[model samples]
Target: MAALMIQGCGSDVGKSVLVAGLCRLFANQGLSVRPFKPQNMSNNAAVTVDGGEIGRAQALQAIACRTPASVDMNPVLLKPQSDVGAQLVVRGKMAGTWQARGYQERKAALLDVVLESFRALQAQSDLVIVEGAGSPAETNLRAGDIANMGFARAAQVPVVLVGDIDRGHVIAALVGAHAVLEPADRDMIAGFLINKFRGDPSLFDDGRAEIAARTGWADLGMAPWLAAARRLPAEDAVVLDRAGPGRARRVRIVAPMFPRIANFDDFDPLRAEPQVDFGFVPPGSPLPGDADLVILPGTKATLADLAFLRAQGWDIDLAAHVRRGGRVLGVCGGFQMLGRAISDPEGVEGPAGAAPGLGLLDVETVLTGDKVLRPTTGRLVSGAAFAGYEIHVGRTLGPDLQRPLLICDDGAGEGAVSADGRIAGAYVHGLFDRAEARAALLAQLGAASDGLDQHARVDAALDEIAAVLQQSFDIPRLAAIAGLEQRP
Candidate 1:
């Protein structure tokens, strides 16, 4: 079995996107390829086919490889609930919550688990493309690191360091990594690649040469800024701050950007609607009163983020919007927040207590130790078919459930709709992915949709990126680095 790991000089350096593109490129060549990340720290998660959850990036990479996503693809997932604490997941199941310092001490012991998963995947594939988290440059965390160099050394996988040229000082970032990484770790890196380059590649010709000459690392290639990448779902919340495309539209939609928001990509399909102007209401700003819809997105911590919503005065804004006859939609944790109350007697999220919800729906939720993770398909009240997944840990019950918004194929009701039909909440993520469902919802909001198919768009974006990488990168060299001969 052969493996190649892609490590970055810093966070948001496009390591995930590159790995996804390479996965597609190799898979298109009829090579059995797999994508693996030993550890991932992000709330953006995707439910696997095995009834488990992993980082959303790995799921996307699995889609790129034209395979089903599995828990083994990402064995360790950390969903941050507080500034210094996160919920640890081992092999796709909840393990426990740990503080930053506490997790650092315990991470080394998980190396065996990580290696076990890697070897399991290695046994079934011709080439396994691995993605490293954060950077190997953080020597302080190198002691028990299972994310970067530590995993690379243990797996005996060759590494290719990626530097973001769009962030400037690409030369220093690459050369600086060489200066800081230990001799053994540095030797693991077989080459370097520059990502997100704008303008002429000739501008960086000398810079690339200087790095290769100074560090003795091969220059893999330079990747240009890919507009197609924007069409794909983003894995990090930082991208939410960047302004979306400006298009003249009829309906205005605002979603509050919570600090611990998870699965925010559920709104990607809405942003693609030409008749909709979708925006994330950042902190310090009130939710726009004239908005047609206020969507409460999913979060890692429900009660804490509900408090955060009130702290930002968004609760007040939402109440006023509802008074003005604006539509409200809640998803997952957001669904729990729209209820009359939320109780966590088990302290599943935080303290064992109950908090009053927004009171839009006549329902109550009790957080429990048991989590529900499943893929589902259902139909809206209007008979529009929709498909989505459920990943939450609570049971909601109330009289409002009698007026369910969706009827699953299993003859079960899901979600609740307000008596006046202006407010709705559901535990389903990816609710608007289906064209018919999205169109039906838009029509109900007095807007017309282009009925875009999100899944197809994502597939097209993957193909586009693969084509670009094939043209710009030296495929033969990369294949050789992965211990594969170039196919004619």
Candidate 2:
């Protein structure tokens, strides 16, 4: 079995997208390729085929390879709930919450499991493409690191370092990484890749050559800015509460930003709509008065983000929006926030306590240890069939549930709708992933539906990206680096 790992100089350097594109490129060549990440830290997660949760980025990579996402793809997942602490998941199940310092001390022990997972994927596939989290430049974390160089050396996998040229100082970033890394770690990097290059590639020829000359790492080649990547769901943590470029369209849809928001990609389908004006209302910004629909996205810490919402005075804005006959919809933690109350006696999200909700829906939720991680198929009350997943920790009950906004295929009611039908909440994430659901929700808002199939669009984007990589990068070098035959 052959394996290659991709590590970046820093976070948000387009590491995830590079791995995804490579996965598709290799898969298109009739080679069985699987993506692996030893560790990933993100609140955006996806339910796997085996009733587990993995980073959404890995899930996207699985799609690029046209395979089912599995927990083994991402052995260790971290969902940040605060600045200094995160909830840990081991092989797709919650392990526990740990502070930054605490996790740093204990993470070394996880290397065995990480290698075990990687070995399993290698046994099943001809080639496994691995992705690293954060950067090995932060050598301070290198003692117990399983995410980057530590894992690469242990697994004996060659590394390709990727630097984002779009962020400027590509030369410094590449050479700086070489200067800072330990001698052994430096040797693990077999080559260097420059990503997100705009303008003329020839303009940076000397710059790339300078880095190769200084560091003596093979040049894997530069990749142009991939516009096709935008079609894929957001993977970087920076995108959690990122605001959209405000442009007025026929339908105005808005979502309040939360510090610990989870699965915000739930709104990607709506944001992609041509007739929709969508943005995330940042902490200080008030919710738009003209918004036709206000969406409350899922969160990792329900009670905490509920407090964050109120501290931003979003509750008042939501109340006013509803008073103006505007629509409101909440998913997962956001759904729990729209109800009458949220109780967390076990302190699963922090100090055990309860928080009053927006009272927009007649429902009460209590945090529980039982986390729902399953793929679901159901239809909206508006007669649209949809496929989605539920990944949250809470049990909700109330009279509003009797007027469910959705009916599951198993004959179970999901979500709640207010008496006037202007307010609704659901525990499901990615409900709008399907074109049918998007059309139904758009029609309900009195907006035109383009009826674009999201699945097909993403698939096409994958193909486009694979074709781009095939032409832009030195695929022959990449193939030989993996000890595989060059492309025929």
Candidate 3:
């Protein structure tokens, strides 16, 4: 099987979206195109049909290609559990936790497994478009690198270098990549693509020519900023901007931005409501004074981020906010923080094994070495049955266990909630996507509420984007580039 790989000049230069676009572009031309990434690092993850987790970006690409996601689509994933340590996922399952130096030293051993996944994808699909992580030009980290050039060499796939024109230095970045690559790696590159061009692409004719002339590489074409891109799901750890279409409300939910924040998508549905406003405050900014609600999102490191929150005077402010009749909602690690105490005697998150919590809820949490992964269906405090998923490993207990906040069918029981309703916390993510649940919460806050079918809306948006790709992109050319053109 033959393929073309998309490698970026640097991180966040739109490699994921390009892979998604190409998948749709190729699939529209009567070809079966599958997306592949040897490795990915993100807190946003999705469970596959095989009941294993992979980064959400690959899942998005799979959706764009109109294919079901599987472990073979993404063989390796790294979820940052701490500043220096990552939870390594191989073949869609947990391999183990490893620190930076240790993982880098042993990375080469995983190349065989990655290549095996690529081989499986190649066998089934007419064209496989592989995506590279970060820049291939990072000479220092090239050793045992199975992500970019190494994966290309092993898979025998030609590469297309993509540079961000909006970032400036498009020519220098492209030229610099060719300069840094070893001769063998340089030969793997088929050409380059200038991505995210804001204005008319014709204006960059001279720049494109210069890049091609300087690097001796082909220029595929410049891609304009696709407005429909927002319709696509984001697969990065960064929180989505929460400032659109939502009306101002008295019951504001202020979420503090923890450094290694995970599962921030917990708040996405709320941002769509006309009667609710959710504000995400980064570390330096003060928590809103007059807000009716404050939320603590999940963190990879519970104890370390708890310390960071207190350092920024958020601890004292949180207490004051509760006194001022503000509601606080915490999810997962945040739920652990709202309890009386959190214990990590095994040093699961860091060297320190223990930390004092905000004590807003009567619960206590103990960190465990193992992670839990399952889809959960439960009843909310308002008695509305909800469906969501849980992917954490913190055991919690509280005095008010009799009144379950979330009654899971798996006997995982319920989360903690304050009796007075001033504070609440749950382990499940995406609970608010349920219209009845969101309306119940908003009703409690005295905000006007309306039900919007989020899942249906998102599906419609994805279909619209696929149609746009069908209309605008050079589908046949992309299919030919991906080696999907069959001889008559």
By descending lDDT, how would the candidates be arranged?
A: 1, 2, 3
RMSD of each: 0.9, 1.0, 2.8
Tens-digit lDDT track for model 1 on 168-262?
A: 88899999999998999999999999999999999989999999999999998999998899998999999998866446689999899999999
Residue 377, model 1: Cα distance from true site in angstroms: 0.7
lDDT by residue (272-362, candidate 3, tens digit) is 6777787687778778787777889888788888999999899888998999888888888898999899999876666648888998888
- The lowest-lDDT stretch of 10 consecutive residues in candidate 3 is 238-247
Worst lDDT window (10 residues) for model 1? 240-249
Higher-lDDT candidate of 1 and 3: 1
Error of 2 at 400 (Å): 0.6
> Global lDDT of each model?
0.93, 0.91, 0.80
C-alpha TM-score for every candidate: 0.99, 0.99, 0.91
| Candidate 1 Cα errors over 4 Å, as ranges | 244-246
